[model samples]
Target: MPPAHPFDDDKLREECGVFGVVGVADAASFVALGLHALQHRGQEAGGIVTHDAETGFNQARRIGLVRDNFTSPEMMARLPGPIGIGHVRYSTTGSKGQTAIRDVQPFFGEFAMGGAAIAHNGNITNALQLRRELIERGSIFQSSSDSECIIHLMARSMGRNIPDRMEEALRKVEGAFSIVAMTRTKLLGCRDPLGVRPLVLGKIGDGWALASETCALDIIGAEFVREVKPGEMVVITAEKGVESHFPFRPNRSRFCIFEHVYFSRPDSILGGRSVYETRENIGRELAKEAPVEADLVCPVPDSGTPAAIGYALESGIPYAMGIIRNQYMGRTFIEPTEQIRNMGVRLKLNVNRALIKGKRVILVDDSVVRGTTSRKIKEMILDAGAAEVHFRIASPPTAWPCFYGVDTPQREKLLAATMSEEEMREHLEVDSLKFISLDGLYRAVGEAQGRDDNAPAYCDACFSGEYPVAPSDMMEQGFQAKTAAE
Candidate 1:
């Protein structure tokens, strides 16, 4: 048949990134800059919606990079307003190609309270069930995106104001959501009760901003205010400053642990911990747990570099660039077909034969989903005359697929789901392969006492397989439900 898709082989993809601003001149410009900083989170399509007194609502949506679409004067000129929201999307709930643009978000709805636009960053696990209920009740969906359910829910709410209506609508929804929304006069941000996604608040000159990460705020020269607390909604207006409301019953926070391992920008801060530092700590922990005698420690490049540095420092091994990545190469996982992905890995990475020849090499990477990429890289390393190849992973084996915004392969497809460490090492044709322990990962992220079995401090569903929120839609669709211990 066909070669497996690269994303299925190794990479886990996040769904989208959102940014919004209020009380700024040409607000869409700031929104564009913010989205540009977040382009790493999602690269397929981007859209910006702005609200102006004279222009009403202005929208620009396109299927490409932010720099390709939003940087042009003509495009910026089309979106003029003092309040705006933008979204960069990588489809998880919708189809791909031309038709997918219909799902490009900052989805707008004309509610009884006027118009409201929302940009969402996480997946709603119960969207399919909610959509069926809404459709039966006469709500017409404009797009196939799960995010559309929020707008329709708001449209049907009888709450007195937009905020109350939004709270009412969200209460009926389930799963991870970090939402940045805009109305005629307000900018809003809120996180799911479990805090499975991230949303931060920032301040610009006299205005306020909301973004999926703090790096988005840094791009626009905004001061970091704080995170939008879990289960809490923050509403900002020029006259009223900022208002906070608890829309869901308080629960233990369960921020996605993968944010520190992957997903987030190195410069961004999540849960008050620096992403870079956390990565380095993961490396240190990996060194302690699985030490290898090697000629050199080399990273897979970019994502694996920080961890490799920590590994080298902890083990007193020399760190070298044994594999160099093509800086200009597009993300190989985003290639549409399996054939392109089959050839894409070579286009993105090259072995430094000069450095790797005759060396006992240790390769560091964030995580391995499918064993394909690892196996390929091992062949490349062996061809370059490496005496031995050892693989050091920063995170634990990805045993479960993430249903909350992160795109993962089915459980049966995950290498870790079926293979033991020894079996994986042999399968990848490496001398040794070691992944960080679940407890080690927690320590790396600053949870010193390790993961709380009673109530996990972070959402590690991919590793632990214990979903904090019930994946109602998946269960209804016949996927087996699992508990943390299972």
Candidate 2:
């Protein structure tokens, strides 16, 4: 396995991205285009499955960027069909060190009626228990992925049709999920009861599309349709359009709040709100809640730019790109040994000595995970002669690990898990460190009265340490949840 990119080590990673289309010519081509737009969600590997009447089910899976793997004529030509689904992934299940071809999805399975391919976003908390029970009952497991359990469960189901089997399989499963699946002629989309992950419907000329985010729809010039409601399943075909059903009991939406902070593309919209606009609002809220008398407001590069712009506008401070990022750097540039690992941040970002020198700069970033990158970046600014460095985080401190689809570090490794705000400020050695309050973050995301303790609008488990869904697997492994006494 190749070494990971240096800068990406401390970041939270979404497990996967899903895109599917029905009723289109060379549907794999459209799927490829959509995956390219969603590369940010997952970058370790990608796969696409397509179905043609004459040729039957076809697929292509590769480990690398979408453009690097899926754009070639031979790869596209291999997948000749009118309906298809594609997945881009960063492995949260299966082998942790490196992703093998077997673990790559959209996972294909042969059922009694026909073959279907499924791509899943979000984690299944009860997968370990399910796998053990299935194996005991003579189910042959192939990949080490939690998602494959869905296929096995579907195979064992006594339902009349493929969708019915899927419904039965998912009914027994727990945790967050947004799934895109396809049979020979039909495309399908479904979200879990909590709507923990995102899946949207889109309309093309005579076709339909489903993607993890709206940005993928825009890449194909598809009209944005309504989102797939929580616990809802939609079966789409060229002739019949979209057929909606409720698989699980209705529940209030608990969308991942980090989608606005750092995950989804800035150009995308979530729950009728623009993600870019929300980040800017977070900046405004941060400026209002935690103001600093700094001469300039600077972002930590690409992810923090929007919020920094908002902060600058609200605070009447000049906004500047104090750090420049290398746009062409893909996931892995060089193999990281102990010493080479230290050079990672410098290879990706460089301090703008001219703009930063003699300026009291306030750094706006989405979140601080391990405090490794934040410390290194602070050192770079001081070396460049910045008078003072202040950190204004767009979201509250991330103290808990996410058990949903997101790949978060263990609680012990998270800086916020062990340290208070002042302790963290002293550890990072910044002039001051302030994170947006939980209520402020809620307000920024359009929750008018802020987060309701009675019924929160979004999944803020990372901030509040109060999980909406039980992490059954972790609990079995003896991981403790926050008690009332704490």
Candidate 3:
């Protein structure tokens, strides 16, 4: 792959997506479907591990989209099992551009009990510390991924069984994690104590499923059972269904709020609320907080569509598809020659010149990350003869990097970290720019009275700069957390 178009590269990337299904016929086939639904969460690579009595444990890991690698009959034939788990990766804690096959997951390991495979989402904050300690104690590591720490930890554990060993391993680990694993006869799922990332349970026919989001389950025709509660571990077998336990200390949940803003597909449900409705509510909140008079409201295409519709309905401005995305634009390029590189977002999105020629357009977008996409889009809208361009972002300013799982730029590389709203507006050269307030974001996500400062319901660390789990690795490298007074 030459490179992902910069048009899609500037946003905060979800680290990975995980899906596991047990008790289904040809479970790896269903796992592939679920991973395809979650391709947005991770497009870099994918893997599936399946277990059967005859084959024991089998896996096929590949680079690129799930549809490209996992869908073929020949590929699916290599994996055979009743119980299976799959992972699609975006590489938050590993090499970025040159990810190796060794780093692709649904990582497999053999133990005294049996062979087990695990797929993980979210970053391990203490992975560096654990890796050093494990290496000192003579534990060899295969890959450069932080998630591999879990396998090593399990290998060193003295617990009686696989589940007990897993508990022992996770207890020594810190930071956000939602994991799906499989043994020859069982499927396993769990979330960190604080539940900083999402993991949901589902039922399909006589079988059960576990996925990072409900959308993945939907693809395999699974019924949404409920979320795997914070700190809860579920071990599912065809005979016993699901057995739940808590292996970590009790703590209040702090789910990632950005999932509602951008990470999840709009059709999915989160916290018992429709993600589409929540995004529209975000638009309504943004309208109330920063009302802008404009001739039309336009979305920056798919991600921004729902919010734009809400803004248009609330502000009584006509909604238009002022910008149309090139639906078939391939994510990877063969090579980025100077001519193609300069095309910028035009390669992916284009202005509806006919409709936008004389309008004062308000563009509703999900977030402003590096600000490269926004600036280029603004230039495109202007070149299309739009009278004025105004920007309304759905989420609050992303001022800090997410240490949990989201692939965020270093704090200083983020536009919000170094510039004020007015400065950003000037930089983008838009008539005006605004982002939804944190309190407004809370209200939109179903908190009627807005955020509770003492203990927020969701992790807004990227916006608020307060991490629920201290990023120990970053601290070791001399990165300091922003204090309340900062």
Predicted structure with the largest lDDT when compared to the true one: 2
Candidate 2 residues 216-247, lDDT tens each? 99999999998999999999999999999998
* Residue pairs whose backbone atoms clash in candidate 1: 9-370
TM-score of each: 0.96, 0.99, 0.99
Q: How accurate is candidate 1 locally (lDDT)?
A: 0.88
Candidate 1, poorest ten consecutive residues by summed lDDT: 1-10
lDDT of 1 at 394: 96
Q: Candidate 3 on 1-486: residue-level lDDT in tens?
A: 533444456788877999999998999999999999998898889999998778778889998888788888998888887889999988898888777999999898999988889989999999999999999999898899999999999998998989998999999989999999988888999999999889999999999999999999898889999999999999999999999999998999999999999999998999999999999999999899989889999999889999999888889999999999888887664356778778888988989999999899999999999999999999999999999999999999999999998888888999999999999999999999999999999999999989999999999999999889999999999988988897
**lDDT, candidate 3, residue 409?**
86
- Point out the higher-scoring one by TM-score: 1 or 2: 2
User: What is residue 166's positional error in candidate 3, in angstroms?
Assistant: 0.5
Q: Residue 454 in candidate 3 has what lDDT?
A: 95
**What local lDDT does model 3 show for residue 325?**
88
The count of residue-pair clashes in candidate 3 stands at 0
The RMSD (Cα, Å) of candidate 1 is 2.5
